[model samples]
Target: MTQDRPIVIGAGLAGLMTALHLAPMPVLVLARAPLGEAAASAWAQGGVAAAVGPDDDPARHLQDTLAAGDGLCDAAIAARILGAAPDTIAALLRRGVAFDRAGDGRFALGLEAAHSRHRILHAAGDGTGAEIMRALIAAVRRTPSITVLEHTEARRLLVEDGRIRGVLVAGPHGAMTLPAGRVVLASGGIGGLFAHTTNPPQAWGQGLLLAARAGAALADLEFVQFHPTALATGTDPLPLISEAVRGEGALLIDETGSRFLADSPGAELGPRDVVARGIFRHLAAGHQVFLDARQALGDRFAKRFPAIAAACRDAGLDPATQPIPVTPAAHFHMGGVAVDAVGRSSVAGLWACGETASTGLHGANRLASNSLLEAATCACWVAGDVAATPAVRLRPLAEGRLPPLPDPAVVRPILWRHVGLLRDAEGLRAALRALLPLAAGGGPASDPATLGLMLAVAALRREESRGAHARSDFPTHGAGRARRLTLNLAEAMQAAAGLADPVVLRA
Candidate 1:
């Protein structure tokens, strides 16, 4: 590959879509795992949210998205992304994505939590992500200008004079540097930092760590969205029972068969944070929470949600015959390397899309099913930005020592205990203390610890309860208008050392 060819990290939707959109413009894609595995994109069950329904439009979708974001959404960015949703969906169809269609030839749109319209586009029932991946992966394979490196993980981005010179990657062949002037970090979320999460274990915030170490500004590191209904069968990374099930009328019930969330606003259809907290509190109260799909879907459950049904049957339970055991698990992160309108990060020649980039569309909380839309839609903008930017002269990269492979095991417990659904200053400070040394060290836990430390500092700084970040000690919204927060490694470390105020960059 030439130095001018852009390198895309991660083989998921965002990375793949970005590469495809840049097609005819040679690009290289690196995947830690094989193309289809270890990607949270393929695990998504809820369909893509778009304003495809006849009665719906981008304005209405934007309204619901802003409401879910809980006052921190970048309205212009949200409007741009949501407004392009229809065209983005059309582009997906052009890329061979076979979204489900009704008998009348219209797109089969399903509803999900916080969505006012039936605009969730699915394929093969609940296996939306898998279907989308199947199509996109096939498209990538067929594209002549795209080069894919499976089993290759990017260890560090080689930056010089504040510009991305190359990427140091470890692959099956061994460690080598790809001297590309342009790079994109599409690596997924930070859910793996939690002990119990719905995200793939590979999503331990590697993208955030890579960008942070390279001096990129990250935003909203405190806003972690916990999905309310991860199927709890004592699994490490629990299987997700999609919120679309509840959109289809499934109820949250306890051991006594009581609708435990009935009194909560929107109940089962509430914003993800609210429902997650409700389930978290319910479980803390010594009651087992279950999603009773039996009364709602019953025999139709298997047909509508084949993937979830198979997961339940694998656990020796039937969704049709019984209530499915459920619990709150870290599902998504609304924080990452902050990007501008065109997906350009603070670092020159580096761009981010998908969950890895905090594009401000998700804000404090992400509306359900909007992740796919964001990843798909923003890929075009990122690609256009990358394509238009003049390629820089490739600098001679030094053979820097490879950082020890990251292990998230040590960081998971600290986050789950202190930084999970509910947080307090004491616990957040304790997390900072425990993570500071590991983050500063050059050991196997450094990367994950660094990410955790950043999150803990952000959480401690934000005193009020807002969106996914609920401070138990301060249970109400802060005064005045809500502002989004941004932090870098220096600021986070300074705050951790108590040498500076933790007031991060607010925008």
Candidate 2:
């Protein structure tokens, strides 16, 4: 009910970083679960990508990012984020985060698929995300002006006139209003909407839905990056075998133990989309797929990647002795509630960062570790911008359209089957037919369904193979420059229902 302190939803890397950057100024942070455990940021294993090496710098990082984006990246945005990475890394180090280092005192880096150099800074081998989040969480907890509300879910935005006033959240005692002038949507991606994903199963694109309902512009909905090597256990939110495993000289093989990636353009170090599709073709043909890292890592697996080693042990697989069964699982989303360079959205008083905000840095395909750096740099930019906005009086609106939420069990499988790694016109159309009904507002499935429908619709339109959005129907790039689409919930829904194109809707 105040304007002096802002409210931040989703206590992930973006939210926590935003809160920390706005120090001395009071802020409210809300999370659906405990801070550290709920965020996909904590699940990042590849580490932050920065140009800290002697032969590497931001220009090279930007070039590699552009190359990986498959010509869909915003050159300006890529330069901005990748350029600031060294400073961001420095800031994290100052916050007491430990990064793996070589004996000569240089930061030890790893090579992931698509990056041109070993510029990724890791912590605790492959536990990079966990380490960064642990440090940020501790720093946030120590900040006196930051008030974190654990187990709090922001369900609605309280908008009056044309500006957002605050958020309506569900707590243990039920729904309550948290009034503020500026509210930031730092919610993570739509990974949970898929049956198999490297992200937490609870990440149901709630931020995308919340922002869309509030009339924010969303872009690149078709681009969802699938990590090529998630542990193929029958677990929800499948455990990830870090790409670093491949960086350490692992090879992808079929059930017959034949190395397949050698046929691709990037080979073992190709872009994520290529690797994922390579594995998928074999999987679709009834061949078992495995990640053959045993020869490369050998007995050093446990010492090099403790977290992955523990996951392997827990799943009844020994990494040092045998190949790990793997499959492509939904990982980072390249699209989201589209945000400006400084993190502002189409809706005033609201901003988004991290995976929830499609800031054009990732474009069609995000470079490894850029997600964490974007979260840090953009959060700071947003904090600075939010500081300048004049406070507005709170005007809470009446509750409306509160509907039963859809079960994840029903939504996840359908999306994974139709819109997973590879897609075609028929599958996308079928997906729209099934998902549009559930996304029809007034249910828990509304958000996930809406986001899924948007992606499927866009995927259908972009009938060509471009970056992560591969369509079997359209195999070629077909010439011309790549165009970016920005749509709201209604426009996206219209396209999903075969009523109108987003271009016509915008017109």
Candidate 3:
């Protein structure tokens, strides 16, 4: 479909904000499901983290962010993002977002894991993500310049002459090509690549795959962030008992009614990667793990964390009376299509924001609640950049040629078994061996799974442990100073093949 406009993939906060900033330009937003249905942005419980409180400052927020990133965070990017917080907050407020307020009408902020101060802004108790999305969606809906096509999945980027022209999308209607002056990818994270995740099933790293296949540079693919405490009710892929629950005094305990985190330094407030690994170790040792909130929050626990409470009740447990079972799950990817501070990807005419792009703000691990802030700030920056550039009509491409999409069932087990939280050389090599044939078979390749494999391949190449990518065999950090990596499918595949079959590991 030829149109004089821009096409944005995914209708989460980032996409919507990008469209809003590029207002008056006809824009089409492709959504795989209805707004608030498929997007993970609405699933966020903790509010956006910014230095909005009097006691907090942008420099302090930047320091906390870099500290949590585990020595890999870019100082300049962290500071730039931190400094943009006030304007981001202002823009959200202008869009009618109703942040929680104190008795004196100041914004009421809350704290989460790894923060040095109370700078997280909340809304409706625990519905901050949904609330922010609701407001943004409303603004998009009212803007005549924006058109949202629901139930539409962006199959691939339509790259012509080394620049993005538009995308091929599969919707309920059928596969169709939508041409635009520019393309923005905000297709969320790689959570769905695992057996368990807090993000929705749609967040399967499709954006990363699409960019990789289209020759876009990717960064930090090895650093997948696993949240420490997803509720373990035996639900398919597990449900998130938000970090806010712990922020409200819930305690993590092993099966023997023993508080495990309490004995660790920082207790429930430890960094997520540390806590997740601790819980995983405990489980491997044959001990069960649970989150105890009954003693601290009592009946208020239910009202405070309704989603968690409901999930517990559905699983036949009462959080007010007993501890809730928990586990670590693949939660976020700190690396994705590498982008500059202005959100422009390596490919000209293409931009990415949100979890889909690795802007280097979230280094080895993400600071809690900083995600929403990144989405808003980066989207705004992209919009401004897009607006400042002179518009050029995109030429039509040879139609009907679409890139392959990978099968989820085929890639899921490989990722879960080999590239999971506790990965070693043996498992990663096995995973690479298993995936090679699938990649070669030439079936519709999944963008997300391909991106996941690229990450695993990168992790395998490193041969040493660092931050979120811990390898038991190489238990120490490598000598190479931390630097970003970007690889194409062929380069990554070659690297994967060179690895010895199940690379032997030493204890």
Candidate 4:
């Protein structure tokens, strides 16, 4: 409502936190849905990864993160973010987030995949994200300078002379343009592009599309982490069985009760990609895989994981009694619009944080519980950079018709069939062919198709299996030290043009 006020898009953890950090500076937050819904953050069950345990330190936390990233993580960036973990946790506490505590008055720490330390701080058992969001939403509401516009979605970023000028948004009444020099994109990830995912179905990389279309550079588009234990109850957007469940000694067993991952290091607690591939192969072999917590947690399952227990009850099953059926589902994207340490994008006056910005922290694979940490820590820095950057003069904007609302329905099956979990040259090529036309078309599917096209092109060019971007034809890591991949819409479209020729689809 005020002129030159910085605008933050999306009302998720990152966006809300950034606005809160901005303080009395006055900022506007736009939410597509109500404050509590349509955000993957609220559905997050694992908790924040921090070096709060007596046995852990930032150095150990950084080591675990790099190990999980599988050698692609930027050590300096990862170290800086991990170093802020303690302060970030304290910041959350000051905002009224009540983390679960041990009987002795210390923080209740849990373990997750890939981390050697029990450094995860959860609240309300498994409802860590919900609890954090509850605190943040209340904080944002109480802040007098922060204005929240609910039920409004950003349709496009208006960049003039290679700088952000304004945003074209669709609100409850109609479409309108909000002129502002500063815009922060916290619009989340691209999970909904796949047929099955643990993310909110609407979390389909809208931020990426906004950044990509505005010529911001994107990095590591091919690395998508698949959580290995989504509840296999035929839900469109699958409910996640937190890695903390496995951390609590659950075993991955088939219908025959064989521990298929017993021979694998870390077994049920292995890094997500490895565990996901194991389950995927087992499922491909016509075996049903389940998370058997009956022995480890039993009746205690209800107490340790109340939220997950309720989900199990809703599905007509009890985690304490029966082995919960599980399958791999798209969970997180390790890549996004490439940003510097301060979250500034390639385009000036435009910044990105949270799931939308690839700050070289997650790299090829994200360590479990690191996502919430990243969002919480980076949000403060993003707000600082935004506040420090000088405001630019505003120009009058012209009215234009809003683009059709995007639909990922058609893009989901194509990505799942050709680009899901396992990929090869033929499938990648076929995907490019099918997606190129849709991306170039003026239709509701174009935004999703464009993002999918970029991913296909990146996957096709990577040439080897590393982290979550596995290639069946090239099953091993490449010969040299891995480098992060970067691309823009033009580069992606150009690559697609060369590869979109008629190709045989895999049967």
Best by lDDT: 4
Residue pair clashes in candidate 3:
205-448, 209-447, 404-445, 405-444, 405-445, 405-446, 406-445, 406-446
Ranking by TM-score: 4, 1, 2, 3
Report lDDT per candidate.
Answer: 0.92, 0.85, 0.82, 0.93
Report the lDDT tens digits of candidate 4 across residue range 1-507. Answer: 337789999888999999999999989999999998899999999999999898999999999999988889999999999999999999999999999999999999999988988999999999999999999999998999999999999999998999999999999889899999999999899999999999999999999999999999999999999999999999989999999999999999999999999999888998899999999999999999999999999999999999899989999999999999999999999999999999999999999999999999998999999999999899999999999998877877886479999998999999998999999989988898899889889799999999999999888878889999899998999877398989899988887888844231211
Candidate 2 lDDT tens digits, 431-491: 8888888878557677678778877777776757788898787777846638676777777
> How close to the true structure is residue 381 of candidate 2, measured as C-alpha lDDT?
92
CA shift at 419, candidate 4, in angstroms? 1.2
Clashing pairs counted in every model: 0, 3, 8, 0
Candidate 3 lDDT by residue in tens digits, 321-387: 9888899998888988889989888888888899999988988889999999999999989888877
Worst lDDT run of 10 residues, candidate 1, spans 498-507
lDDT of 1 by residue, 378-464 (tens): 999999999999987676666667788889999999999999999998788889889989988889899999999999988887888
TM-score of 4: 0.98
User: Could you estimate the TM-score for every candidate?
Assistant: 0.98, 0.96, 0.95, 0.98
Model 2, TM vs. native: 0.96
The Cα RMSD in angstroms, rounded to one decimal, for candidate 4 relative to the true structure is 2.3
Instruction: Count clashing pairs, candidate 3.
Output: 8
